[model samples]
Target: MCGIIGIVSHSAVNQELYDGLTVLQHRGQDAAGIVTSDGRHLCLRRKNGLVKEAFRTSSHMRKLKGKMGIGHVRYPTAGSSSQAEAQPFYVNSPYGISLAHNGNLTNSSSLQRELFEQDRRQINTESDSEVLLNIFAQELHHQNSYRVTPDDIFKAVAGVHKRCKGAYAVVAMITRDGIVGFRDPHGIRPLIYGARKTEGGIDYMLASESTSLVTQGYEVVRDIMPGEAIYITHDGEVHTKQCAENPTYNTCLFEYVYFARPDSVIDNVFVHKARMRMGHKLAEKVQNEWKDHDIDVVIPIPDTSRTSALEMAMTLGVSYREGFIKNRYIGRTFIMPGQKQRKKSVRQKLNPIDLEFKGKNVMLVDDSIVRGTTSKEIVQMVRDSGAKKVYFASASPPVRYPNIYGIDMPAANELIAHDRTEGEIAELMGVDRLIYQDLNDLKDSITEGNNELVEFDCSVFNGEYITGENKAYFDELQQKRADSSKKKKNKRAAVDMCNSQ
Candidate 1:
């Protein structure tokens, strides 16, 4: 849900970090930050905006001049949008440490309560990053060490990992040595490392996505293994340690379906290839089910679904057309502020090209339909552009369940396809026919020879939650939601009674 990067080079690494963050800007647009270690001190700057808007002037980049640094672009998961919630969160005590993190921690509420009860440490922000920083600080204080070696760092992180549950990919900067990166045991999120070939020597770079590294002239080494930690010293010495003994690889499937850029790769699997496979599988299903009908053209919704559309076009033996032109200036419609704004934004976000759709029986390819709002708008747009008939093809199965893992999907009742049949959904969207990728088909697409290219966390699709070592935390979350709903109902009743009086 966020992007993180770190760099260690013989020369100043400000520019490299800046460019890497730019490549990762798509992962998050809410906030951007960077912390550079100048050996003597860590220069930090963070704000709520895009990378270009946040770091507008040369003076902003010049302030962070150091051989090693860490950067983050944040998408708010738990906390309210504010300057304090923005990351590269620093703790001054025990050797001035700054940390940036991606992914959500399910046990954070429990851990926060425990930390507050044990030690009178007031957490300033609601973000789990601050909780993580405080936990590391507490461990350092408990060990009572000043040297803060790599071993000490690993032990501190392991202690926090034992207490914490859920996903996290972290990058931290220390005053003395340099940058360190770590991924959660389940590997629900992604983190990769790259090395730039410099004139003097090699520079190490760590990022949430590989495209960032490629943009900054660094060749990707590999994805940082799940439950693994790597520390890149100021002198370019890379030290690694494993935090979790037997790690489960539960890479998020939504990343391939929607979140990640097509150019990025995760867990040794190319994102674009995975999407293409999904499209091909969908095409096969459609051919099997609706053999009588003819699909004249396969038209992509633009941007994210283009790769899948191309594969669908080839599979169906239909010509592929760029039917929709996306407005490059607007933010993503899904992440817009409100439903009203998102509905209005969708019109501005995409426009159907009349030449491509006129008199054509178009099959519109898209990744997924969450609430079906955007799909309905797009279907109407295509029909208005003179398409004879519109057939909608979703590359992924219907999202009938809620995504508790950081994706901002609404509750099950709010999902359009959750209760409605495919025929009903097709009528609601005003499409001639609608086809969704089957769940089994999606699973089959990613299967290789005795090995899956990526292990998927499809809890949202199947309603089968994979309980990790931290099963108790899942129970706690369910209970908490129940209590919150009860409390809201009670408050509403009280307010109504008072008004009646």
Candidate 2:
């Protein structure tokens, strides 16, 4: 997943784009980039780091002078985190275009192969964004028009949507025309627009999350509709059209559970509230599973689990305490270099407070366990902190299946819960008791009355693949993951033998 933002303004928009990307820094911390169009040139800057680190200071922002701009903060999904993979990818062939994208394209491998074989277009990096840019460029070239108009841009984007099969939310800036934005047919990723009333007129902005708009002194206009394309011109002319109709809405449920910031509102639902409901629902599961255990304290893994932990604590009538202190210098364990690094990093990332857990029965709440390595480390840390007993509660259900959508998860075999029972998992983690949120409870928590905030693509949790035309492809993907796991194990064994020698 990644973060994308675009703006069409009367004044220079570099600072605005920078501020918006700063607010979206939580969505992606691996890399940051911005491309601004001053009606002539698309000034661009990108690097592998946080937005603050990439730009260094305001002087860097001053270099990009433009009335229209697009920015990106990237978390690698299908690509390596490198300078070449950093986004705001540009193509100046038929017309100068700079684009940033969020979400992964499941059919990108197939599409890239087709492009390479037929058109001989070489893909440089492993980024889906570069593939998207090449696709747009190819479409523009095929049109063979002398002058590119906003309609041409829309048609090109619509064509890409028709050919592509996966989740994507895109923001782009054309050299002369203005800023354009679109969301994939599934609407798996969020894209919201905001407007700022200025002296010249109203400036339009689009961002992956709404909190960025709020930070930039703009009121949220609305979320970009699924299967829709919007174009805003330099003259303040806003045009919108439905590129596709009645697309399946499988907005990522993980956004609420962990990815997005608490303040960000996605698809008209507050993220923090949804997580709290997940906690409340999880509490019900815990109460049913372990009626005899006395829960003295509810402790959250710091940062992401704070709100959900509070809700669980309130529902279970337990005292909540800051049991773990997270090291601010460390990045997220999941985003670290490798599996070995991730396992080691967790120990340095969090430290249990002895005051909160000493001789106490602590119910530890965490968002989710991908591979169980980090969860095991955290449980061990709590035990070492003098806890008499540790009960593990996961806000989301066990992820037995890999997420092909965008989330980076190991294959099914690597998932501790895929083949093991809860009791088995509890023993492995060295916890006294383990409770997982029921799938039904997870669905109900995200839905209110008869209205669901977002339709979930929960293949990872349920093994019920929901892609309409690509059901066979998703089935194949699941099988491929199983096969890949075996290969990885064999490779690791070979490496172990070499080391022994």
Candidate 3:
């Protein structure tokens, strides 16, 4: 997953874009980029690092000029971690468009071949965002209009919805025209637009989360609907159109379990509130199953799971304590590409508080267990800290299938809970008991917040791909992940040898 933001303001938006990206830094840590349009001239700056690292100096910010711009923080779910794949990808054709995109396209391989053979466009990197940019540019070119209007832009977006087969939330700047924002038909990813009234005129901003807009004093208008496209002219005029054939509002459930910030709202449901409901629902299961449970204290894994853990403690009538002190400097272990990197980072990322675990029947709560590397390690850490009994609870159900849209866990075997029963998983993790939230209860948790949300992209738990199940695609994805893992291992060995010399 990635974070994308775009702005059309009465003044220069370089600093605003930078600050917005900083707020969204949790969405991605690998790379960051920003592109600003000064009339017809586009100024670009992108690098393989966090937003603060990428735009470090005054000169970097000063170089970016314009009233409209787009920014991106990338976590590579589709491509390698090379600087060449860093985004805010630009194409000169179709009136000079610079685009930033979140979410992954499942049909990108076929689209890449189509672009080269049929569309006569060249793809520079392994990134699907580049292919998407070219597709949008090509579609706009088909419009054949010297003066592009909102209708032409909406038509181009419709062409994109017809061709692309996976999730995408895009924000593009068309040189002198304005900023455009659109969501995929399924709404598998989040995209919200808001407005801020300025002294000069009304300014508009679009981003992957509402936090990016609200933090900047922008009043959230609403989430850009499934299969909808919104165009904000350079003069602050707004126009929108439904671009997809038959759109459904199936937002990704993983966003509520993890990823999204607690303060953000998506599809009219508050994220933190949903997570609290998850804790309450999971608490019901615990109360029914383990009536005489001796959970001494409920301790959260830290950061993302804190809200749920606290609620779970309150519901279960157990004392809540902060057991893990997280190192804020460490990158998220879940998003790290390699298993070795993730394993190594867990210790550096979190340290167990001896007092919380010592001689107590400790119950640890985490958002969800994917690979189980971190969970197993944290369990061992709790044991090492003298815990008498260690129990674990997952706020969401087991991840049994691959998340093809945009998450990193592509191989089923990599998921500890994929083919294992609850008892088997508990044994493997060395926990005394393990409780996982039921899928139906998890759905109710979110639905309680917003009744309108009828479905979600819970493909990771149910193996039900909303786009359609393709065994060939799964096979290819597994092979790609295996190959990438080998390459990373070899590269690490080479680096270690060089350092020793």
Most lDDT-accurate candidate: 3
The residue-by-residue lDDT of candidate 3 on 411-480, one tens digit each, is 8888899889999999999999999999999999889988999999999999998998588888877876
- Per-residue accuracy of model 1 over 1-501 as CA lDDT, tens digit each: 889999988888788888889889888888899989889887888887799988899999999988989999987643455666778999887788888888877767878887799965678776778888788777766767767778877887777668767778889888787787888877778999998777888899999999998988889998887788888888888888987767778877788788888888877777878888888888888788988877899998877888889998898888999888889888766544446777898999898889999999999999898878899999988889899999999988888765666665655665788877888889999999999989877765555311544567887787665434355654544443332443453355456446644
lDDT of each: 0.80, 0.81, 0.91
Ranking by lDDT: 3, 2, 1
Clash-forming residue pairs, model 3: none
**Per-residue alpha-carbon lDDT of candidate 2 for residues 249-303, written as tens digits (9 for 90 to 100):** 7777778778899888888888888788888887777777766768899999878
- Per-model tally of clashing residue pairs: 0, 0, 0
Task: Quickly count the clashes in candidate 3.
Answer: 0
Clashes of 1: 0
RMSD of 2: 4.9
Candidate number achieving the greatest TM-score relative to the actual structure: 3
TM-scores of all predicted structures: 0.90, 0.91, 0.97
Q: Please report the TM-score between candidate 3 and the true structure.
A: 0.97
Candidate 1 Cα lDDT to native? 0.80
